[model samples]
Target: MKKFPMTVGGEKALREELDDLKTVQRPTVIASIAEAREHGDLKENAEYHAAREQQGFIEGRIQELEGKLGSAQVIDVTQIPHTGKVIFGTTVDLINMDTEDTVCYQIVGDDEANIKGGKISISSPIARALIGKEEGDVAVVQTPGGGVEYEIDQVRHI
Candidate 1:
């Protein structure tokens, strides 16, 4: 499987989630299953069925988190040399060329991308265009509405 790039913060978040699933959720589901099993027959018990379904979901999520963590390549933006260019894990300040509206975005992994939080996925059109670009460079992003142009005002590694 191809390894996915992740920021140090993103890796830590995944690790924390994995720990929670293993130490908290897994044990809780197991106990719930045991209690449900003790209550009634295996075939007709609604509680048992529900517990089993919950167990399945918990196990599936655990596996997914483990796989993602195992294949993740964590990159620490702070440790990398600052070249004043846009790169993964870099927070960039931009100005819309058309409207002259200022915006800030942190380029991160797919799992860490949240538009509301000012984080954009590395694979996104805007990030792709910004990669390797320095301040004063213009990035043209192809959006569903149309093409949008942004001027890179600043890049910060944090």
Candidate 2:
């Protein structure tokens, strides 16, 4: 199996979710299903159907999280020595060459990528371009609009 690169924080969050699913959600759904089943005939039971659907969804999520955690290779950026080059789990500050706009992004695993959170996936175009690039290096990211050049200002392993 291919190992997925994940930040320490991401792994923790996933583990928490899995725990909640297995301990809280699973039991709650089971209880709901039991109660629904007691209510009426299985053929015309809306509550039972809804509960079953919810149980299926919860189980699916639990399995997904477990699989991800099993295949995860957690990287604690804070524990690693800070290097000038950009890498996974590193927060990089970039300056747009043309617009002169400065932005910061943390390269993270796919599960942790959130644009609003300033986290980008490792497979993203910008992150792929920034990977292995040192401070003062220029990374050109090809977007749907066009190519955008960003100057690596700083890289922080945090």
TM-score of each: 0.95, 0.97
Model 1, residue 120: C-alpha shift (Å): 0.9
Q: Indicate the residue-level lDDT of 100 in model 1.
A: 97
Among all windows of 10 consecutive residues in model 1, the one with the lowest summed lDDT is 39-48
| Candidate 2 Cα RMSD (Å) | 0.9
Per-residue C-alpha lDDT of model 1 across residues 24-49, encoded as one tens digit per residue: 98898889889988986889988888
lDDT for residue 69 in candidate 1, whole number 0-100? 86
Best by TM-score, which number? 2
Residue 61: error of model 2 in Å? 0.7
lDDT of 2 by residue, 60-84 (tens): 9988998999999999988888779
